[model samples]
Target chain A: MQVNFWDRNQLRLTPVFFLAPAMLLFTVYVVYPIFSSLWISLYEWNGVGEMFWVGLGNYIEMWEDDRVHTAIWNNLIWLIFFLLAPLISLGLSIFLNQNLTELRFIKSIFFFPFVVSPVVVGLVFSQFYNPEYGLLDFFLKSLGFQPIAVLSNEEIVTFGIILAALWPQVAYCLILYMTGLAGLNREIVEAGRIDGAKGWKMFWNVILPQLRPATFIAVVVSVLGALRSFDLVAIMTRGGPWGSSTVLAYEMVEQAIFNYRMGYGAALATILFFLLDIYIAWFLFRVWLNEKGRL
Target chain B: MKLFISIIVTVSVVITTAMAGTLKITQNSSNANTQKLWKEQIIPLFEKENPGIKVEMTIYDHEAYKTAIRNFLQAEPPDVVNWFSGNRMKFFVDQGLFEDVSDVWAKNGLDSQLSAARSTMTVKGKQWGVPLTYYQWGVYYRTDIFKKYGLGEPRSIADLMYICRTLKKNGVTPFTIGTKYLWTAAGWFDFLNLRVNGYDFHMSLMDGNISYEDNRLDKVFDIWGDLARKGYFIENHASLSWQEGQAPMINGDAAMYLMGNFVVPNLKEGGLSGKIGYFQFPVIDGNVRTWEEAPTDSVHIPTKAKNKADARKFLAFLAKPKVQSMVAEVEGMLPTNNQSAAPTDKFLKIGFKVLSESAGLAQFYDRDTNPEMAKEGMKGFQEFMVKPDREKQIRKRIEKVRKRIFKK
Candidate 1:
């Protein structure tokens, strides 16, 4: 009847003790903020003074807000175009996966964009896109064409910024793919070659399945990057020529900080969280399915 | 429990010791010259004059300070804070964030000394802060270009149109502006509104009393859009910043810029000192009085300030003619105190004269309006500048924001 106290509870207590730090941090910083932002969205707070209850008012306002519509459209453009990063980088990784002696130099050159900060990239691109003294204008003028001010034109400003964002993003995905290519199963490749699978067939049938984890991560990162695009838009355009190039994240910050509408900003943040959550849930479901198939 | 009690006691003692005889001041200034003036000159002077009171100053970057002040005012406010006059000041005043310092104004007789800026600093007929310095906004032109085109300073809308036509005929852009930051476009809107409808109407519009689609504003945009449509502004101006817009005038591609007195220093730094000339924005309506945009910077005591008496002393000291003149000289701005020595800089001198004769002062478009309205309004102005045909849509969009913010 007399049991050892440590032995009886150790199974449950050990895991809880070990997980406490992480769980505490996650709850405080992540879980708490997500709910708090949702709670804040149901009010009319200007960040400093009073918080008046106005349930779903902020979200209802979003339905009528033109800037919100523009932001959502821009976010869609970013997402669609961002998927190109992984596709382009996969090709780049494959091309660089050669036995040439100078491939290391080329690989490092390809990886250079990822090393630079986004702000630095944005500034450089801004200078490059300048109408009067920019490289783009210089090229256009030399080609006997009228210079186009890409960043100023609302139609093309988002695309111009996306191109700048893609420079670093492509390099990031390239690094991920290179690692995947490097860690490929040599035995499976040889067996595929013996079975007369060459070039695209060998890679698509054998190598790709092995690189699933890396592909998943790269696509997920790209999607996240596209959804949360802020710094480049802030630096290059400031959501201008009149809010044409704003994303949800930038609008959220702009509303909270510049416009001083904390409740509306929280509503924006909440919407973004839901969008990200849906993608994450789908990703988790896919991974669970894959694990079951493996089992 | 013993350790906890000891820690609490230690913190309280440290805080009280830190608070005693120390006056903390926070200012929004990113300029190294201003920072150095405060550290080496202003603080030293204040501390020297008051032997028992020590001055501690913190300077935040201009844009960062806008957001930071809101948080710090509620959490841990400094004794004195520097901010703009007009609606920006009224915003905090309405929230009871800033202390009413009419006593400081009355005791020092700033009513007459800083009369030009008194209206802006006053909200609900009580002075909220002490005006320190302000700079005028006008048409900064390339004097050489004007002379070459046989153009004198335009006195009326007709003369301005003639100047524009003459400049455009000579293959020179009539004006250079960068609407990339949006506020530069607001400057144009401010002048146009002030000139066409007058200051009272402009102030009412800024207060969200008048709709953006009002007939009064149609004339404002009509004049503005005519310039935009006539290709009077520098090409691809929407892509350029206020600094970048200077390149066109500096290179003589554009003839003029309707900008603040701050641009004079930039012009001087760009090595076009004497070549630049200041002129009041030309008259649009003969009957309407001339109103100038002069953004005034001032100091205030926060409601929760620990050492309010010392803060009042700081504000009073800041308002002194000698101190004002010295600070103004360092900042390359005109002193708000009329009793201060006249600015010796040529452009500053002209600005001071123009402002002295103006019917009333406006604190520029963005400063005089609700922050949300300012953001949307400036965006609309920038859009209108870029696409003149979109004026109606832009005005309607801005009107939507105005209605929401003002509950009209």
Candidate 2:
């Protein structure tokens, strides 16, 4: 009845007190906003104006919205491309792991794209894809091919931005894979080689299962990255040539900020959150299973 | 205690400061000349006239200004704010964020002086703000290229088509446009609709009273589609910004561009100023090429402004012919005050002529229409340009957005 919440001497209370700042911050910034957005999603509120509640109207509208489908399709493309990043990064990490001369030095250079901001990365690739003076166009023209308008064409614009996104994404995955590869059990690898497990088989069986933690992290990051593919689409195409390149996150922000459709935007955010939440739950379950198997 | 004494001193100073009342003005531009005009001319002059009043100006660059205006206006309302005329302003005004300044208009007799842009400054029945500056959007063509091809300034739809044909024959694109940001396409739509169906029909459509799939819009898009299909626009235009589209015009590869007077500065930057000539977008229906896209920029006081009395004085000061002329000189913009002389620049003089002869004014498409509808409609316009065959689909898409946006 006379509990002192701030008592540091009490072990259980001490941990709670230690966690209090972070918990408070997380509640305010993360938990509160998530619920607030959910509540807002039920209303038809332009951010500045008074909110008028229209329960389920925004969700019903989303069901009929074709643009949502387009965004999902684009997000799917991003997901597909993102899945390749880990494999590519793993392959790249392994190749660089070899004690070739200056290989370590080359790695920092390769990771240069990751260090560059997404906005800068988007800008650089936009220049590369610019039809008139772009390096890609110039190279294609030199090769006796027609100059390609990748960003201009609606169908390919998402692909173009995704490819740009992958440049940095691959670097991040490469770092993750390299970290995983470093923590690999060398004796098991040596034993696998002794047992005639070589090359691809060595990678598939010996190296991979041990690298599960890193692979899981990379895949999770990639899925999140794909779902939240906003910056590249925003900077390069702006979901343009007719919303063909829009991803859910970008469209949500577009609706909220530009269109002043906060209610609709909040609905989009809720949907994106739920979709990601499902993936996260499945990922956690897989990790739990993997850990249980290890035990 | 020393702390107690310091606190007491601070309280009195704060009270004095509160009584003095700072008139905060938030503007969306930080142009060097404009800033200089504010510091050297307007602020100094206004302060001299009223010794007790202090002007606090907070300026933002374009992109930051766009979002910051909304946030700052509502949270810590400034006495005055700068915004675009027409629907963009109406958006905030309707939300009751901007203070009604019809009293300022009536007292100053602005209804007569600012007659040209008066309609645009009004939302519903009330004038929510005052138009301070505006610039005309029309066709800007390479004078030498036109002369070289004997392209008499296109006077009608037939004339425009003939120019396009003649330019193509000479291996020149008739018009260079970049729809990367989507609003460039809106410029095209505004002109075509204004020309083909005239102003009232165009305003009706923008007001969402007329449907996007109307026969009138069909006619507008038909002409636009024909233009696009003729290979008249810059190649790979959807990838380029309006600034990048200026390149072909600079190089004489494109004969003309339909853009705002803002593009004139870019032309100067591109070192192609003297070579370019201005023309109102030629008649389509030949009824009259009177309705021009001259998007007016307005100033307003927030309804919650602390120093409204000073803000009104500021707005009144902003409305004076000398101040308007100073703005015109400083910004290379058309003055809203009737008495202020238009700038003497060759291009500006012609802009004045075009505007003065106009039967009425139209805010540019994005400025005139609801933002949500404008976003979809511009996208539809961009798509239509790229694939004119999909005109019906595009119109339907825009119509769908319009219905959703305006219905509520």
Candidate 3:
């Protein structure tokens, strides 16, 4: 085959030409905002006024802020508890991966929470936790137990909001796992079974290894979701009962919008961005290693 | 068909040319009745009186207005906008985002008519806005419940404590407050601080001159903590909104709410109109003079307003006694114009008397303080109500915020 210099140049430029628009969009929407936020974090600017260079003043203030401490602690707690979604979803998906006709209906019921909006979920859970006239209160009283106001108590309010978030999150993870299960190799499972692997051993040894991609996706999504948990806290609690339920994302919005501390809020957002960036980098590195090993 | 289209275009042009000025107003009011009065009555009356100027008004819900005003004032400035008084108004005034309307105040003799709110509206000896309406904060109690318990309006802290004890003995919560939004708790803090440490101390605290951990505030917290620890407040108050807090009071499960005159309509809707009664927060110290929380809503021209002349005209119109009287009647709030007719609503009448007799007026806590400090301070107040034992910790946290915000 005879190839001219134009054809070689055309081949290289075609991919670049195709990628230019996406790269431009990504730069504008994603990359530029990150740098803009980083720049804004160094200034003491109200949303509508002159920007005063404060350098690390905002970060220093955030470091000593008790609310920031509370928010960071709440984020950590959310990260820890949100892992349960994938683990529980895996079990539920395995149980429902059957041929029974009735199981399909049961599976849909389990998927119901994911269909509802997070706002509605927060409101429903808020009513459920209402001490004066809620279902939990009613049941507790009927059972001769003290009615606990879950959302009001500072010590347990974060847990209460997490439980509400977990409902939809577990459903989301279950769907991911179920699709992964459907694509599993039947021959490998049969080989494992014929080699005397059965039940727990067969699932753990054969089925689990096949679900790696799904597991990886589920974990990454769950971690990101946990880190950005603003809606439920904003709706159900508003980081109330003295901000005991606040997370970094909610605090950032509260600072920026409600408190009109735009510079401080930018600093908070920068911190969150870096935290997310480190996780993503680690994830990509692990995936690269996996690919290199396979090759 | 061509002739008809031409006629339509000509008519629209004529209509547009007939009006010499377009006055745009953006108001922050969540009250449907108030919005209706503005659209149906206020705007029509203004336009009818000033045929050459067409007035346009847009109302936003309370919270949305806070952020929207910041953007529009910088980008597309309205002719006139409604805002708060005190430090809340000063936030924009200092930035020169609000036009100096001293001439309007002077031309209309608003200095004397709106003298009550003049201090709040003034910065560096220049008037920034015209006061619209104000409402008092006090204890709104069920008169029937008080009668049943044989308790007259509390005269002093001791007397209030006795009433609280009586109500508690009868198995009713003495006070109903919701701290979900946090400002409601600041109302309690304002009254307590005013009563215990006096108005000057309270103002100093709001200005960030006094630390939250200052010993002068110790007595105020002690009283508040005592009330909280004694179970005088409704249980799980941190979970409800200010509106939801009224449910207990309306149901007779709770006796009183320390709120503004704005709660009157909600109480009336809750079926406690005739039975509801108002009283000033009782004295805690004989030496301290009485100060009232009377947050005033006001109107101003943005510095970037296109029609400054008409905006001033609109402000002067709003300053008139008759217009203010209508505002007071429709809103069930006290008119800021001293020459305005007395408010017709019974609750507002009492509120007027209380405010008029007071030695000084303080805008509500959140309004008087820096926005950042107010938020943290209100949150601390809410926490104190929930966990009275954490008073020291909460105060320390609020003080930290105060230092950072005020650079103290």
lDDT of each: 0.92, 0.88, 0.92
i-RMS for every candidate? 0.6, 0.8, 0.8
TM-score of chain A of 3: 0.94
| Number of the top DockQ candidate | 1
Candidate 1's displacement at residue A152, Å, is: 0.7
Tens digit per residue, CA lDDT, model 3, A100-216: 999989999999999999999999999999887899999999999999999999899999999999999999999999999999999998899899999899989999999999999
Instruction: Give the runs in model 3 whose Cα sits over 4 Å from its true position.
Output: A1-20, B1-20
Scanning candidate 2 chain A in windows of ten residues, the lowest lDDT window is A1-10
TM-score of each: 0.96, 0.95, 0.94
Q: Say which prediction, candidate 1 or candidate 2, comes out ahead on TM-score.
A: 1
Q: What share of the true interface contacts does each candidate keep?
A: 0.90, 0.90, 0.85
Over all chains combined, what TM-score does candidate 3 have? 0.94
User: Taking the tens digit of each residue's C-alpha lDDT, what string does model 1 give over A62-103?
Assistant: 999999999999999999999999999998998999989899
Query: How should the candidates be ordered by lDDT, best one leading?
Result: 1, 3, 2
lDDT of 1 at B366: 83
Every prediction's TM-score for the first chain?
A: 0.94, 0.94, 0.94
Give the per-residue Cα lDDT of candidate 1 at A128.
98
